[model samples]
Target chain A: MVKKEKDASTEQRILDAAKQVFVSKGMAGARMQDIADGAGINKAMLHYYFRSKEQLFEIIFRDSIGRFVPKVKALITSELSLYEKIEQFCDGYISMALENPYIPMFVLNELHKQPDAFVRKMFNNELPDLSKLVQQIDEEIKKGNIKPISPVQLIMNMMSLCVFPFLAKPIFSILMGLDELQFRNSIEQRKKAVPQFIMDSIKR
Target chain B: MVKKEKDASTEQRILDAAKQVFVSKGMAGARMQDIADGAGINKAMLHYYFRSKEQLFEIIFRDSIGRFVPKVKALITSELSLYEKIEQFCDGYISMALENPYIPMFVLNELHKQPDAFVRKMFNNELPDLSKLVQQIDEEIKKGNIKPISPVQLIMNMMSLCVFPFLAKPIFSILMGLDELQFRNSIEQRKKAVPQFIMDSIKR
Candidate 1:
């Protein structure tokens, strides 16, 4: 039992270190040696654990996507009003993103680099069904709780508001002349404020 | 005059090709040879026109940022009603982004790669001021024209909704199972619907 726990801990350490390197350097630029260095292991240990760079990246990427997609799916299916869902989504996504700001950019950059491979992999993975959320939006519109609008638009809007800040962090920080702490504080402020702003704009 | 016109045309061609390559491949992955190939020019001619890859990239990046900032500034300072301004901003931003689906991602990726350099260039270029927009939002709130909210939050939300789709095209396409046409149509729909959505949520 102890040995199993130790192996699990070491594997997690490699994953964490690999994620950091991959996020910063991207696939082409990241090196196994660097990941090994970051994980405080030798290259042989890295190979012993993950076998190859591609395998390691796939594991990290899938792990990152898994973390993000399930929460979004849960938001879609939750027993909340549309207004409440928007609020939940904004707060939840921003908070989650704050903890993993690099994930969106990392996923996006790789997707741009290898669209076919990334898309196929993502699709093969179980993703959230947005159709249910769409139906909910339609019902809300039909019931006169909100104005008529496509759920896709709402989803896009909600997601954009939630994710763009992290994706554009460097430019946003530069444009706003914010340091790391200041940038983080701004995002924290947006956590509550963005949802309120969205609700204010959309509620009947 | 003829020579000047020809030079202008060549420069425009180079810019267009550069935009396509840079947007698709990103800065690190993009090469001058590929850009020249895309433009149907020889490598020496490409260099003669733009001096270096960095110089060529700067032209496109600056031009893109210039196109984006002014329209947003107009949203803030225009004589339209608060609701009208919001609609106009959403419509304009979505339209522009959809047309150049790769611009946001390209700019964002480069910004991440070289934050300080990009930010300094943008700052030195005199980005649009949001002070007037802030004041306008304050006035709107005082008169109860819209829900009371921070202008910064409002602006960020507006931008986030408009920009995130293009930024996350790969993931969104996979998650939603949208082909290029469906994705394009969805954006077109957003152009018309986003303003109303925003108005519905915010207007008392």
Candidate 2:
């Protein structure tokens, strides 16, 4: 049991180190050696664990795609009203994005690079089932709670408002002439602002 | 004059081919040999026109950043009312993004890869002068044309709605169960939808 726990801990350490290296350097620039060094393990141990950089990258990529939209499916299907669900979703997602700013760009760029991998992952994994959300939207629209618009587009708009600020931080910061802290604070403001913006646009 | 004209044509051909290659493959994946082949020029002639791949990339990168926000400064300084300016800007920007869907991802990802290059380009190049735009927003707010909100946030929200869909296309497409044509159509729907969404949120 002790040995098994030690193995699991070591694997977790390697994963944590690999994520840091991958996030900073990207797939093209990242090296196995650097990941090993970051993990405080020898190259041989790294190889013994992951076999190849490609294997390691695939693991990370899958994990990233999976983690990017956690709780959205649950939140959408929850007992909350449409407005409450959207508020929670926007708030939760923006906060999550602030903590993991690299995930959006990293996942999207890698998807562009390797569509086949992403396609396979998508097929294998259970992504957010949007049909329920669509039904909810229909119910809300019928009940005159919100405007009639495509739920997909509405969700896309909300996600865009919440996430795009982080993805395009450099350009937005430069254009707005904001320093790092200022830019971060601006994004923090969007947690509330985005939900309100969406609700204003859609609410009846 | 014939010699100069021929040289100009050759350089233009090389640049066109290089843009195609670079836009598709990105800077790291691109090769001078492939670019030369695409241009139907020998490597020697490719070298004659551009000193190196790096030089070629810099030229394209600079041109891209400059072209991304062309006419923003001009539009802001134009005699149009704030509502008209925003309506035109949102319409024009969304249309442009739909046509050149790769621009947002390419610019933002490259900015992540090489901040120094992007910073120098942004500073040296004629990016949108936002001071005037902010002033215009203030004038409009005083006149009660739009609700009081940070001009920077308003601009960010506009851009986020227009561009983030393209940047996160892969994820959005998969999660929304949209194929390429469907995704493209949804984006087309947004050209009108986004402006209306913004107006609904901000307009008095």
> How many clashing residue pairs appear in each of the predictions shown?
6, 0
lDDT of 1: 0.76
Residues B1-107 of candidate 2 have per-residue lDDT tens digits of 24566445888889888877776556775678889998888889888988888898778766765664556667877888777777788777777777666666667
Which portions of model 1 show Cα errors greater than 4 Å?
A1-18, A29-52, A74-88, A177-182, A189-195, B1-15, B40-50, B67-85
lDDT tens digits, residue span A1-204, model 2:
144764457677788888887766677767788888888887887777788888988787667656645566678777787788888988988877787777766666677776656655644656666777778889999998888899888989888898888778877777678899999889898888888888888886
Residue lDDT tens for model 1, B1-204: 245664447667778888998887887778888888877887897888888888888888777776767666656667777777778887887777877777787767767766777656665666556677778889988898777776666666667777888877877787778898998998888776777666666666
Model 1 chain B: lowest-lDDT 10 consecutive positions: B1-10
What candidate 2 gets wrong by more than 4 Å, as runs, is: A1-21, A31-51, A56-70, A119-124, B1-21, B31-51, B55-68
User: All models, DockQ values?
Assistant: 0.51, 0.55
Over the true interface, candidate 1 deviates by an RMSD, in Å, of 2.3
Q: What DockQ would you assign to candidate 2?
A: 0.55
Q: What digit string (tens of lDDT, one per residue) describes model 1 on residues A37-103? A: 9888889989888878989998887776766566766777888877778877878777777887778
